[model samples]
Target: MKKEIHPDNYRPVVFKDMSNEEIFISRSTVNAKETIEIDGVTYPLVKLEITSSSHPFYTGKQKLVDTAGRVDKFMSRYGNRNKNK
Candidate 1:
């Protein structure tokens, strides 16, 4: 609850998630050079790598990688030393 400790230039900005191509509008003080039109209105466009719409924690969607192939490759290269011991 401190006075004059916050920014005064708060405005509506558009945050675009690059991963999922989702856009949302919120109030922020960030400076953006790009502008985007949404619903016949223009807002400062900000590009983001991850957002609530695309994040794994919020959307419960996880990308599964093929780790078994990597493990097998590593074991074939270095796991032979343990077999002789």
Candidate 2:
């Protein structure tokens, strides 16, 4: 691991907008524009979609979580499939 041999691995790292201490970096943007600062260093933010926040899972309170129309699609596909029968 020679310093001179290493070609100055200087690159930009991404940090999620308004995150506590989490950070990420990639080649492409996942979503709209956002800004984040880490250790006094500012960087562009990316996707921050939450699957489970202060919801049921973390608190061990398993609850039915319906998405947009998953159940509707399932019912429409399988439920109505045997209607003519």
Candidate 3:
């Protein structure tokens, strides 16, 4: 409640390059580089590689587990099996 001693808490925070599904409630956690432009006003845009829209878990689509079949092959080689059984 002290004046002139409080930290600056009034700064514009915006996250850029977010997926279309996460833009409405998205806010930047810290200052980031963004290059956003709207109505002649431009700001920095954040670039994200993946979000709920692109993530495999959130979208309910399983990602390709390329190593899955390899595991079976390994087990067969290491594990001993009875020839008649």
**How close is every model to the real structure, measured as TM-score?**
0.71, 0.31, 0.43
Indicate whether candidate 2 or candidate 3 has the larger lDDT.
2
**Residues 1-85, model 3: lDDT tens digits:** 8889855654444453244534322444455665656567655455666776767788898765557688678668865565536
Alpha carbon lDDT of each predicted model: 0.92, 0.58, 0.57
Which residues of candidate 1, in runs, are more than 4 Å off? 65-85
Top lDDT prediction, candidate number:
1
Q: Candidate 2's residue-wise lDDT over 1-85, tens digit each?
A: 6658754544564744232334466545344466667789766676454333323565576656679988888898888766788
Model 1: per-residue Cα lDDT over 11-58, one tens digit each: 999999998899999999999999999989999999999988988899
| lDDT for 41 (candidate 1) | 94
> Can you tell me which runs of candidate 2 are displaced by over 4 Å?
1-22, 27-32, 50-64, 67-85
Would you list the clashing residue pairs of candidate 2? Answer: none
Model 3: per-residue Cα lDDT at residue 38: 55
lDDT agreement of model 1 with the native: 0.92
